[model samples]
Target: MSSTTRAARPVPACPIRPGEPCTLCQVDVTGPQDCGLVWLVMGDDELRAGVHRSRLAAPGRR
Candidate 1:
């Protein structure tokens, strides 16, 4: 008998939250494109600013 395995594809980083991988944080979301959180954050300047601040605080800036 022969068996084969396939490697898992790497998840792309969250565009709304820079420098962060898509962790499937939202149960309803399959990816950033359909994520409600991403939509909400992006729609609000304050919330989007917060995400930007977090990315800037990380060790290596994007």
Candidate 2:
């Protein structure tokens, strides 16, 4: 008999939720415009949208 194994999915290093602020936002970047995290998040449409929605829902942002 043969058995098959499924590959494990990759997880993000940061603990923040999809709609929450990313690690980049939590830190001080020397070049905010060139933030790698921003690029990474933007690569995923759902995640990027969630982040934007979260930012808009944040307190005092209104």
How close to the true structure is residue 35 of candidate 2, measured as C-alpha lDDT? 61
Candidate 1 lDDT tens digits, 2-61: 999999998878967678899889987899889898899889999889888888887787
Error of 2 at 61 (Å): 1.2
Residues 1-62, candidate 2: write the lDDT tens digits. 99999998543333224333334554565333556676677778898888768767767653
**Ten residues in a row with the worst lDDT in model 1?**
11-20
lDDT at 54 for candidate 2? Answer: 73
Candidate 1 RMSD computed on C-alpha atoms after optimal superposition onto the true structure: 2.3
What's the TM-score of every candidate structure? Answer: 0.69, 0.45
Off by over 4 Å in 1: 1-8
Give the CA lDDT, 0 to 100, for residue 24 in model 2.
55
Local accuracy by lDDT, each model: 0.86, 0.57
Best of the candidates, lDDT: 1
Model 2 alpha-carbon drift over 4 Å, by segment = 1-29
